[model samples]
Target: MIHITLPDGSRKPFEDQPTGLAVAKSISEGLARECVAMEVDGQLVDLNRTIENDAAVRLITTRDPEALEIMRHSAAHVMAQAVMHVYPDAKLTIGPVVEDGFYYDIDMQPLSEEAFPEIEAEMKRIVKAKIPVERHEVSKANALEFYKNEPYKTEMISELADGTISFYKQGDFTDLCRGPHVPHTGFVRAFKLMRVSGAYWRADQSKAQLQRIYGTAFFDKKQLKAHLEFIEEAKKRNHRKIGTAMDLFSFHDDAPGMAFFHPKGMAVWNALLDFWREAHREAGYVETKTPIILKRALWEKSGHWENYRENMYTTEVDDEAYAIKPMNCPGGMLLFGTRPHSYRELPLRVAEIGLVHRHEMSGVLNGLFRVRSFHQDDAHLYMMADQIQSEILDLLRLEEKMYSQFGLDFHLELSTRPEKSIGTDEQWEVATEGLRAALDAYGRDYLINEGDGAFYGPKIDLHIKDALGRTWQCGTIQLDMSLPERFDLTYVGKDNEKHRPIMLHRTVFGSIERFLGVLIEHFAGKFPLWLAPVQAVLLPINDDLIPFAEKVASTMIQAGLRVEVDDRTESLNRKVREAQLAKTPLILTCGGKEKEAGTVSVRTLDGSVHYGIPMQQFMQQVTAHVAERRLELDLFEK
Candidate 1:
C-alpha cells in the first residue's frame, strides 16, 4: 500500500500504485476532467505518470498559474508536429516556452508570414484529433537509436548525464523532452503563430542557421484574443516609433547603439536630472564626477577585469591599457579612499551621474533601452555596520518618491549572490540579511530571485510597469562588502581604531537614457507640462495678430515657462494641429478680440478650450501646473 498526501493535509491509502489521473478520479470526476498535470513531491509530472511511493501531490488544472506553462509547452510539441506534417523534409532542432509564448527552431526553408495560415490550420487539425500524449523513458542506447537521423537530438543526448532519457509522443510525432505537459493535444485549444525569424543553431552564429517560429497559447479563445489585443496596444506604444514621430532622439550609423538627443529631448533629460539633484541634495548627498577612462589595473583590483572584462571597452593610452567605465562603484570607492574619514562622517553619500559604456551585441542594440553609451544615476553610501537598516530605509523612501513623481508603479525583487560573486559566504549572508530586513520593515511585498545579483554583492531591484503593462527594470540598491576590502577603505571609529565601512551602491534610474525611453512610451510622448520641451505655444489667428502672439510668448517666457510663437505663413487651424502633434501641453491663441481685451484663448492638448481668459489669470494657472509638475491639466477648469 502507498499513502498519498494532499495539499489540504488529507491522505489516501492505495492497494497498488496508481496514476495521478486515477487518484484525481477517486476524489472527483470533475477534478480529473479539469486537471492537465500533477505535482508529486514538489516535482511537476504528467498526470498519467504512475506514483509508486508515499508522497505529497497537487493537481494542476487550467485555473492554476502553472497550467499556462504546461499548456504552452504542449503547444510547442503540437506546433512541431504540425510543421512535420506540412513539410516532411523539415528537420527539428529545439522547442521551448519563453515569456508570453513558445518557439521552435527548425532546419528548413525560411518561412515568412505567408506560411503562418497553413501551419496554424494544421495545428488546429491536430488539436481537433484529441490525440493522447504518452511519456516514455529509455536507455541511452535505445534513445540514440531512436534519434539516429536527428542530429540535434543526438547532440543533446550526448550532453545528458542521466542513464535514461525521456521522450513524449502523440500520434505519429515524437520529440525528446523533460516535460510536465498537458495531457493531450486537445488541451491546446487556442493558439496562434506569431512570427518567424532567423536563429543560428545552438545560438552560435557560425553554426547552421535555423528558422524560429514564435507562437502563443491560452486556455480559451477569449483569453487568446485579449492577449493579442494587448500585443497590438504595445506595438502602438513602441518607443522607437513614438520617439521618431516626436523627433526627440535619433540613432545614426556612425554611433550605433548610441542616442543623439535633440534639443527638445535634452530639455526633458535636463528636467529629470534637475529633479534628481534636488532630491539627492535634500537627502544629504554630495555629488561628484569621475574620469570616464581609468587604468585597467584599477578594474582588476575591483574584480571587474576578471568578471566583466568582456563587456568593457578597453583602449591603450600612454603605453598603458585603460577601460571605459562600465560601472561607477569602483571610481566611488577610490574617491572615498582618497581622504581619511572619522566616525562622524561614516554615513557619507557620494552621488554621480556617470557616463558608462558597454559592448552590447549588435543584434541586441535596441534604441535607448539597450545602448553602448549611457549615463547612470549612481550613488554610493558608506556607513557603519549598525547603520545599514536605517540607510537602506532612506534609500527606499527616495526610490518611492522618485518613481511616484512620474506616476510609475514599481515592484521590488531581492536578488541573492550569484555563482561568480566575490566576498566570503558569511559576509554575503550579513549583507543580504540587512537588505531583507530593511524590505521587511518597509512593509511591502517583494520577490526573491536566487543567483541574480551583482558580482560583488546582493541587490534589491525595482521593475516599473509602463502604460502598456510591460515591466522594465529601472532602479536597484546593492550592498557590497568586497569593494571596501579591495580598496582598503577605512575610517576612525569612536575608539580611535580604524574600521571598514559598509558600502551601499544604488541607482534610482539605472540609466538615464533607458529611463527616458521608458518614459517616452509611458506617456506616449505627451509629457506633462513641466517636462514638456515647449510647455506652451502661441498661435496667431492671422498675421495681423502676430504682435499679440509675440506679446503672450514674451510674457510666458518671462514667467520661466518654455514658450514658443508660431508666426509662420500658415492658417490658425494648421498651426494648432502642428502644436497638437508636437504634444505641447498648452496652445494659446491671440486674435483681434483677445488682443483688444488683453486676454488669450487657451487650448489644451485634449482639445478643450477656455476662451478669452485674462492674461494674468492664464499665467497663474499655467505657472501653478508647471510648479506642481501636474500629470493632468487639473489646474485649469474646462
Candidate 2:
C-alpha cells in the first residue's frame, strides 16, 4: 500500500499505485472534477501520473495561484496549435509564460495586430474541442527524430543532456515541453491574443528574427475581463502619454535614449533633488561630483571591462581608450583612494547624483524608463566590518522613508552572488549574511533570488508598486568587498595597521529618470501640492478681473509659491478647463464678487470647490499643505 499525504496532513492508503485522479475521486467526485493539476512530492505533474511510493500530494484548482500558470501554459500550446491549424507553413520556436501572459515566437509570414481576431477565434474553437493533453517521456534520440524537421526544436534537443525528455501532445499538435499543463484545452476558458511583435531568435541580433504573438489567459471570463480593464487603465496611466500631455519631457531621434526635460519637468526634478539632498544630509552623507568619463584602466580594475563590457560605451581620448561611465561605483572607488583614511572616519557616506551611459539595444529603448543615459542617486559607504549590519539597517530605513514620502508601497528582494561574480566564497558568504541579518532585524518579509546580484556583491533590491499595480525596481542596497580589494582602499586601524574597509554601494532611486517615469504613472500626472510644477493657477472670470488675478498671483509668488495667472482673452470656463487639464493642484478664481470681498474661490483637481474663501486664510491653508507635502488635497473645506 502507498500512502498519499495531503496538504492538510491527512493521509489515504491506496491498495495499489494510483493516479492523482483516483485519489481525488476517493476524496470526492467534485474535487476530482475541479483539479487541473497535482503536486506530488512538491513537484507539479499531470494528474494521470501514477504515485507508486508514499509521498505528499496537493491538488491545484482554479483558485490556486500556480493553477493560473498551468492554465496559461496550456493556453500557449492551444494558441500554437491554432496558429499551426491556420498557417500550416509556420515554424514554431518557443512559447513561455511571462509575468501576466505568454508569448510564442514563430517563423512565419509577417503577422500584425490585425490578425489577432482570427487567431483568437481559432484558439476559441480549439478550446471548445476540449482536447486532452497527454504527456510522454522519450529518449533524446527519439525526441530528435520526432522534431527532425523543425530546426529550432532539433537544436534544443542537441543542447540537452543525454537523458529522457518530455513532450506534450494535444490532438494533432505536439510540442517539446516539460509541462504540468491543465488537464484539457477546455480549462483555458478565457483567453485573448494581445498583440504581435518582433523578436530575434534566442534574443541574439545576428540570429533569425521571428514574429512573437503575445496573449493572456485566465481561469474564468470575469478575471480575464478584469485584466483587460486593468490593461486599458494602464494605457491611460502610461508615462509617455502623460509626459507629453503635461509637457514634462521629450525625446529626440538624434539623442536616442536621452530625455530633454522641459521647464515644468525641471521644477519637479529640482524638487526631488532638493528633498534627496536634505535627507542625505540628515543621514550623514556628503555629496560629491565625479567625472562623466574615466580611463579604461579604472573600469578594468573594477571588473566592468571583464563582466560588463558589452553594456559599456568607450571612446578614444588622446590615443588612450576611455569609457563613458556606465556605473558610478568605479569613480567612487577612485575618490576613496585619493585620500588616506583612518578608522575614526569609519562609515564615511559619500553620495553622488552622477550621470551614466550604457548601450541599450535600439529596439528596447523606452521613454525615460529605459534610457541609455541617466542619473543615478548613488552612494558608497565605507565602514568597518562590525558596522555592516547597522549601516545596512540605516540604509533600509532611509529607503522606506523616501518611498513613503512619495506614497509608494515597496517589497524587498535579497539577491545573492551570481555565477559571474568576483569575490572569494568566504567573503561573499559574510557579505550576504550581513545583509540577511539586517533584513531580519527590520522585521519585514523579503524574497531571496539566488544568482541575481551585482558582479561584485550581493544586494537587496526594492520593487515599488504604482497606483495601477505595476511594479518597478527602484532602490537597491549592495554590500561589496571586491571593490575595496580591487582599488586597494584601506584605513588605519587602532592596531596601527592598514586594513581594508567594507563598502556598501547603494541607490535609493536606482535611476532618477526611471523614478520620474514611475512617479508620472503613480500620480497619473496629478502631482501633489509640493511636487506640482504649478501649485496653483489664478483664473479671472473675464478681462475685468485680470488685474485682481495678477494681484493674487503676485501675493502667492511673494509667499514662495509656484503660482500663475491666466490673464489671456480666453473665457472663464476655458481657462478653468485648461488649468484642470494641466493638473494644477489648486485653481483659484477671482471675479467681481471675490475681488470686492478680497476673497478667492478655491477649486481642487478633483472638481471640489469652496466659494468665497478669505485670501489670507486660503494662503495659510495652501502654504501649510505644501509645507507638509501632503499627497492628498484635504485643505479645502467643501
Candidate 3:
C-alpha cells in the first residue's frame, strides 16, 4: 500500500500505484471533475503521473493561483497548435508564463495585427475539439532526434545534458515542455491575443528576430471578463492619458528620463516635497545636497564597480573618469568621511534630495515610472549600535505618518543579503538582527525576499497600495554597515577611541518621478486641495464680473492659495465645466448678484454648491482645508 496525504492533512491508502486522477476520483466526483492538475510533493505534475510511495498531493482547481498558470501554459500549447495548423513550416521555440500572462516565441513571418484574427479563429476551433493533453517522458537523445529538422529545438536539445525530457501532446501536435496543464482543451474557454511586439530570439540582441504572440488566459468566463474590464479601466486611468487631460505633466524626446514640470506638475511636486521635508525634519533629520557627478574611484571603493557598473554612465574629465551618480550612498559616504566626529554626535541623521542617473532599457521606459534620471528622497543615519532599533522605529513611524497622509496603505518586504554581498557573516547577522528588532518594536510584519538585497546589506522595502488595488514600492528603509567601513568613516567614542558608525539608508520616495506617476493614477487626477495645481479657480459669470473675479483671485493668492482667474468671455456653465474637468478642488464663482453682495458661490469638485457665502468665511475655510492637507475634500454633504 502507498500512503497519500491531501492538503487538508488526511491520509489515504492506495494499493500498488495510483494515478492522481484516480486519487481525486476516490475523494469526490466533483473534485475529480474540477481538478485540472496535481501537485506532488510541491512540484507540479500531470494528473496521470503515478505515485508509488508516501507523499503529499494537492488538487489544483480553477480558483488556485497555480491554476491560472497551468491554464495559460495549456493555452500556449493550443496557440502553438493553431500556428502549426496554419503554417507547418514555422519553427516553435519556448513559451512561458509571465507575471500578467504568457508569450510564445516563434520564428516565422513577421507578425502583424492583420495576421492575428485568422490564428485566433484556428485556436478557437482547436479549443472546441476538447482534445486530451497527454504527457510523456523521453530520453534527451530521442527528444533531439524527434525535432532534428527544427534547428532551434535541436540547438536547445544539444544544450541539455543527458536526462529525461517531458513532452506534451494534444491531438496531432506535440511540443517539448514541462507541463501540469488542464485536463482537456475545453477548459480554455476564455483567452485573448493582446499584442504583437518585437522580440529577439532568446532575448539576445545579436540573435535572429522572432515574432512573439502575447496572450492572457483565465480559468472561466467571470475571471476573464473581470480581467478585460480591468484593462479597460486601467487604460482610462493611464498616466499618459490622464496626465494630458488634466495638464499634469509631459515628456519630450529632447530630454529623455528628465521631467518637464509644467505649472500644474510643479505645484503637485512642491506639495509632495514640502510634506516629505516636514516629515523628515520632524523625525530628526538634517537635509544636505550631494554633487551630481563624482570620481569613479569613490564608486570603486564603494564596490559599485563590481556590482552596478553596467547601469552606470561615465564621463571623462581632466583625463580622469567620473560617474554620473547612480545612487546617493557613495556620495553620502564620502561626506561622512570628510571629518572626524565625537560619539556625542553619533546617531546623526543626514538627508538629501539627490538626483541620480542610471541607464534604463529604452524599450521598457514608461513615463515617470521607469526613468533614467530621477531624484531620490534619500537619507542616511549615522547611529550607534545601541540606537539602531529605536532609530529604525522612528523612521518606520514617520513612513507610516507620511503615507497615511496620502491615504495609502503599504506592504513590507524584508530582503536578506545576497550571495555576492560584502561584509562577514557575523556583521550581516548583527545588522539583520538590528533590522528585526526594529521591525518587532514597531509591530510591522514583513515578507522575506531572499537574495534580493544590495551587495552591501539587507533592507526593508515598502510597497504602497493605490486606489485600484495595485501596489507600488514607494517608501523604503535599508540598514547598511558596509558603507561606513568601506569609506573609512570614523567617530571618536566617549572613551576617546575611534569607532565606525552604523549607517541606516532610507527613502520615503525611492524615486520622486515614479511616486508622482503613482500618485496621478491613485487619485485619478483628482488631487487634494493642498496638492492640486489650482486650489480654486475664480470664475466670473461673464466679462462684466472680470474685475471682481480678479480681485478675489488676488486676495486668495495673497492668502497662500493657488487661485486661478477664469475671466474668459464665456458662460458661467462653460467655466464651471472647465473647472470641474480640471479637477480643481474648489471653484469660486462671482456674478452680478454675488459681486454686488460681497459674497461668492462656493462649488467643490464633488458637485456640492453652496450659494452666497461671505468672502471672509470662504477664505478662512479654504485656507484651513489647505493647511490641514486633507487627503479628501471636507465639503459639506449634500
Candidate 4:
C-alpha cells in the first residue's frame, strides 16, 4: 500500500501505484472530470503519470490558475500536429508558452496571414477529435536516431547531456518536449492563431531563418471572446498612431529605436519632470548627474562587465575600452565613494534621471515601450542595518504619492533571490526578511515571486494596472549588500569605527519612455489638462475675428498656458473637428457677439459647450484647473 497526503492534510491509502486521475475519481467523479493536471511534491505533472512513492499531491482542475499554462502547452502541441497534417515536410524547432499566449517556430516556407484560416480549422478538428496525449521517455541514443531527418531537432539533442529524453505523441504526430500538458486535445477548446513572423533559429542572424506562428488559448470560449475584444480596443489606443496624428513625436530609420520628441511632446515631458522634482525635494533627496560613458575597468569592478557584456555598447578611447552606461547604480557607487561620511549622514538619499543605452534586437524594438535609448528614474539610499525597514516604508509611501497623482492603482510583489546570486545565505535571509517586515508594517498584501530577484539581492516589484485592466511592471526597490562590499564603501560609526552601510536601489518609473507609453494608452491620448501638450486652442468664428483669437491666445500663453490660435481659411465646424481630433482639453471661440461682450465660448474635448463666459473668469478657471492637476474635468460647475 502507498500513502498519499492531500492539500487539506488528509491521507489516503492506495494499492500499488495510482495516477492523479485515479486519485481524483476516489474523491468525486466531478473532480475527475475537471482534473487537467496535478502537483506532486510541489512539481506540476501530467494527470495520467503514475505516482511511484508516498507523497503529497494536489489535483489541478480546470478552474485552477495553473490549468491555463497546461492548456496552452497542449494547444501548442495540437497546433504543431495541425501544421504537420497540412504540410508534411515542415520541420518543428520549438514551442514555448509566453505571457498571455504560446508560439511555435518551424523550419518551413514563408507563411502569410491568408494561411491562418486553414491552420486554425485543422487545429479545431484536432481538438474536437479528443485524442489522448501520451508521454514517452527514451535513451539519448534512441532520440538521436529517431530525429535523424530533422536537422534542428538533431542539433538540439546533440547539445544535451546523455540522459533519458522525453517526447509527447498525439494521434500520428510527435515532437520533442518536457511538458506537463493537459490530459488530451479536448481541453484546448478555444484557440486562435494571432500572426506569423520570421525568426532566426536561436535568435542568431547567421542561423537558418524560420517561420514563427503566434497564438493564444483559453479554457472557456467566453474568455477567448473577451480577449479578442480587448485586442480591438488596444489597436484603437495604439500610442504610435496617435502620437503621429497629434505631431507629438517621431522616429527615423537613422536612429531606429530612438524617439525624437517635438515641441509639444517636450511640454508633456517637462511637466512630468517638474512634478518629479517637487516630490523628491520634499522627500529629502539630493539630485546628481554622472558621465554617460565610464571606463571599462569601473564596470569590471561592478560585475556588470562579466554578466552584461552582450547588452552593452563599447568604444575605445585613449587605448582603453569605455562603455555607454546601461544602468545608473555603478556610477552612483563611484559618487558615494568620493568622500568619507559619518553615521549622522548614513541615510544619504541620492537621485538621478540618467539617460542609458542598450543594444536591442531590431525585431523586438517597440515604439517607446522597448527602446534602445531611454531615461531611468533612479535613486540610491544608503543607511544603517537597523534603518532598513523604515527606509523601505518611506520608499513605499513615496511610490504611493507619485502613482496617485496619475490615478494609477498598483500591487506589490516580493521577489526572492535567484539561482545564480552573490552574497552569503545569511545576508540574503536578512535582506529578504527586512523587505517582508516592511510590507507587513505597511499593512498591504503582496505576492511572493520565488527566484526572480536581482543577482545582488532580493527586491520588491510594483506592477501597476492601467485603465484597460492591463498591468505593467513599472517600479522596484532592490536591497543590495554586494555593491557596498565591491566598492569598499564605509562610514564612521557612533563608536568612531568604520562600518558597512546597507544600500537600497529604487525607481518609481522603470523607464520614462515606457511610462509615457502607458499613460498614452491609459488615457486613450486624451491627457489631463496639466499633462496635455497643447492645453487650449482659440478658434475664430470668421477670418475677421482672427485678431481677437490671437489676442486671447497671447494672453493665455503669457499666463503659462500652452495655447494656439486657428486662423486658417476654414469653416468653424472644420476647425472644431480638427481640435477635437488633436485631443485639446479646451477649445475657445471668439466672434462678433463674444468680442463685443468681452466674453468667449468654451468647448471641451467631450463636446460640452459653455456659452459666453467672461474672458478673465475663464482664464482664472483654466489656470486653477491646470495647477491642481485634476484627473477629471469639472469646469464651470454650479
TM-score of each: 0.97, 0.97, 0.95, 0.96
Error of 4 at 64 (Å): 0.7
The worst-scoring run of ten residues by lDDT in candidate 1 lies at 629-638
Instruction: For model 4, give the 10-residue run with minimal summed lDDT.
Output: 629-638
Q: List the residue pairs that clash in candidate 3.
A: none
Q: Report the lDDT tens digits of candidate 4 across residue range 454-559.
A: 8889999999999899999999999999899999999999999999999999999789988998989889889999999999999998888989889988999999
lDDT of 4 at 72: 95
lDDT of candidates 1 onward, in order: 0.92, 0.92, 0.87, 0.93
Residue 594, candidate 1: C-alpha displacement in angstroms: 1.7
List residue ranges in candidate 3 displaced over 4 A.
none
lDDT of 1 by residue, 1-638 (tens): 98999999999989999899989998999999889999999999999999989999999999999999999999999999999999999999899999999999999997998999999999999999999999999998899999999998899998888698999999999999999788889999999999998888886878999999999999999999999999898777777888887778999999999999988888888888988999999999999999999999999999999999999999999999999999988888889988889999869999999999999877678889999999999999999999999999999999998899888999999999999989999999999999999999999899999999999999999999988778999999999998999999999999999999999999998999999999988998889888988888988888888887887888889998988899999878999999998888889888899999998888888889988898898888889888877777775665
Query: Model 1, clash count?
Result: 0
Q: Write the per-residue lDDT of candidate 2 for residues 340-456, one digit (tens) a residue.
A: 899999999999999999999987989988999999999999999999999999999999999999899999999998999898999999999999999999999999999999999
**Candidate achieving higher lDDT, 2 or 3:** 2
The positional error of residue 398 in candidate 2, measured at the CA in angstroms, is 1.1
